[model samples]
Target: MRRVLALAACASATVYFEETFDSGIGERWQTSEWKDPMGAWVWTSGEWYTNEAKAKGMQASEDMRFHAISAKLDAPASTVDKELVVQFTVKHEKKDYAFCGGGYIKLLPGEVDPKAFGGDTPYAIMFGPDLCGYDISRIHVIFENKGENLLKSDEIKLDYSDKDEFTHLYTLHLKPDGSYEVFFDQKSKASGKLEDDWAFPSKEIKDPAISKPSDWVDTKRIPDPAAVKPEGYDDIPAEIPDPEAEQPEDWDAEEDGEWEPPMIDNPDYKGEWKAPMIDNPDYKGEWVHPMIPNADYAPDTYAKYPDLTTLGFELWTVNAGSIFDNILVTDDKAYADKMAADTWAIIKEGEKEAKDAWKKANKDDDDDDDADVDDDEEEEEEEELKDEL
Candidate 1:
């Protein structure tokens, strides 16, 4: 029993990686080889008023192009554990609104060349928030298994409220039991089994051998044999001359065409008959296809990447102004929660206060400009009056 207990202790979770960006990105993080002529990633002291607090962080160059950056692990970390968690904070501080960009990170295999990374590079896992025009605002959770990269089939909706501008934490938890959960600002926004959410072959498929018979009485209604059409039903004309219509008295029948009143719909006319439906006595309920084991389907152990070597942010943005910081990749959930509470919870309040203050100052500046414009218009009016005199 003591030997088993010792083995269980050895398998517990540990914090294998972290990056707070307090000190510079250092030599560990490397920029990708794929470069956009228009833009690049830069390290700065945050954006807006938040810059005053944070000494160093990474953000896009605010140009309309792509940006890719990566950081490799000292050694590959094994993902064969029961649970794996990744957490990071991102701030979309584009004052005029963000158009399109990806705030996600990718977990690449050990064999990848950090310098040659691009969008086409293969990754073991890809997860985070992605935004486009008004329609698309979602958290993407993609996993690679057996050479096929499968995106989560179900929609992962995100809160696109006013709070999006502030720095918010995004967390993804993957378990060996084939379950996953996504958290926003440390709150669970979405959770589901991996197999059910991903676009993989169904574990059970309809039995192809069985099918509905040709003579199956699926219809609920039949023509009534006792009921007969009314006596004058066929004789009744669809249209008749209007009773209130009158012919013109000046009509000349010899030279001009004959004058007639416009036809009106016959009130007695009835539409085509349809038999009234009753409960279907011979109905075999709705025909359901019997499910059979899918020959090609295999259960995912959720341990696809036993060795995770590199983590990177390889994405494209149209109007770039997003800051990414405090990335943590660990097998321990407790450690991740603690880090978020300590770092994110503390600084978020200050960031919000500063953002609000900046907005108020801009409003005041605009009001003053309007006053100046009004005064100039009044002076021009006085000059026009003098010229008229």
Candidate 2:
């Protein structure tokens, strides 16, 4: 043991371990205080410690005061099956059982708030000195969700000395192939493979396969390995037919196809709306019409029309069959009433007005003709006077 200690110390002296805090500002280490029948202690922040020379500087307070708690390192989340090394030292504060146990190291999910959280799915490695004769050590892990305790708290009796306040190391090893072994003082204490060597209590249990025994001991009862069914029973049924398969029997003919064009049932649609040839009932513009009937005559022939070259207005098929220049109106009341009375009446009225304007213009043209005739008559009179002279 002396040579072993020296070798361990030398190996540890070669390597260094350190703790890193990645939390942001105002969020450093936090501790929780709790008191129960087991006693009172504070839970601190998660830390990583390794057996190295640097750990000498990182040692817990050597002062004869409060006992420093040890972290679980990497314990099993399901069955304490993972390899883990728990390290802690005992102290003599008042010399009267100052430190109780080394406390416990729990494998927690990386930083989650408990109040906002619901389930307690953490795994742990726990060891507290027993008030009874021997010191107790346990790799406590849980596989079930929201459970309060480990699935198989198989308390393994650790072979250790009791009198002195010494530092002890417990290494729990779990192989990649699902085999587990526990080592105390650098020596293997237990060994067993997972599914084959040990069996679970039930095939459908949430607890892992670690809840089995390697071989039956004299005192303990090693029950028969849990039963496992054949491969296909694990999955859902694959042969069931779909209820929504496409079929004429399930189809509703009345609801199918293009909604029957809402036109057949609606009475408001009077087949065709013969556009009234009169001013629109909704028209609020000046009403104008052409003197000559031209199907191609545009309403804006008399007024300034929009620049069709710059505007994209060619999309419309002009219904240019109406006889009128565009009617301009400030109110729709007269136009709507007149249009409703007789579609052709509005155009007749505009035609009358155009004829009157034309008659007046022709009368002016006749007056102009007479003025030219008078000039010729005046010249003839001048010539007669000249001859008489």
Candidate 3:
């Protein structure tokens, strides 16, 4: 154990891993065999124009299905530290802006076959955003403890509405105290205890033998027994003839059956009789399930991943147009925060400005094209008149 601690201390002293994709994916990154004939991983200077600058990034899919890519750290790092931090940025720029793709990454352990990586491949941690149709649009933070992969039990609602079409930064931090924090664009979004958030069976559960008494009055209100229906209430008809409606002066009684007044909804008619309700004096409060020590439940001491080796991105996308960049994995919170501030903060503001400029340029081009079409139409009409003359 002494030697192990010494080795881990040496490994954690230096920067664990980082990627910026400025010069394109080099020899370190490897991609899986293309599942579809048209599927591809594209490296572009910028997917969209934002002010005058373009975002140079890597896109994992090409509007195709079953796309997968992985970037294994040249020097695999250990996650067996007092704290672990992971951060990355993603941009979804699909033409229609409605796409089903993964913005998350997977951190793998031990040696992994980069050529054959897929969804079933086991990973130490999986964190990022995922969207599918209308229902699934959330950031997923899953941790592999023991032999089981446990997902956070709480639903994380991400902002993926139609108007949301910009780059977003995601960060995850795991502490030795068995707590975790999730951040979006440097803002703390969610945090909780690992044991409480994950789908681990509770150490304490509701007592099966305990139940509320049969006579317990849970209803808050009760019908008044003394309240009675008013006199002649039932005599009021649901409909009555309109006395104000005038009949035609022509004697059409024999031609059109009997001259009867048209029936209309009666103003005085009440639909039904019901007793008034009042607060019940015997009403009891809400019943809470009594919990006791679960005989089958056993607490888990969160294990450290001292052998964490590889990190990768394995995904399946339907309308692929997600750009991933600026990946960082380390045990240093200060380093992670600094990287976010230096990279994301600078690029985010520029990206927004470039996006607006691009929209204006495209609109102007469209307007010019429309004017040329109108001029051609006028020339064609003049030519037809000359030929007639």
Number of the predicted model whose lDDT against the real structure is largest:
1
Residues 323-379, model 3: lDDT tens digits:
777788777777777767766776677665666565556566658778567657855
The positional error of residue 360 in candidate 2, measured at the CA in angstroms, is: 99
Candidate 1 stretches greater than 4 Å from native: 1-13, 35-38, 50-55, 95-98, 208-217, 222-231, 242-263, 275-285, 359-389
Candidate 2 lDDT by residue in tens digits, 1-389: 00111122223211111121112111222222211111112221112112212112112222222221222212112222222222222211111122232222333433433222212323322322222212333433222232334343355444333322222333344443455554433355566643322223222333332433434232332223443444444343433344444455545666774322221233222333233243333433432332333343322221111111100000010111101111111112222223222222222233334444444555666497786686578657545643553
Q: Which clashing pairs does model 1 show?
A: none
Q: So what's the TM-score on candidate 3?
A: 0.70
What's model 2's lDDT at 103?
22
Instruction: Put the candidates in lDDT order, highest first.
Output: 1, 3, 2
Number of the top-ranking candidate, with TM-score as the measure? 1
Candidate 3 CA-lDDT value: 0.71
Ten-residue stretch with the least lDDT total in model 1: 1-10
**What would you estimate as the lDDT of candidate 2?**
0.28
lDDT per residue for candidate 1 within 106-130, as digits (tens), equals 9888687877787888899898888
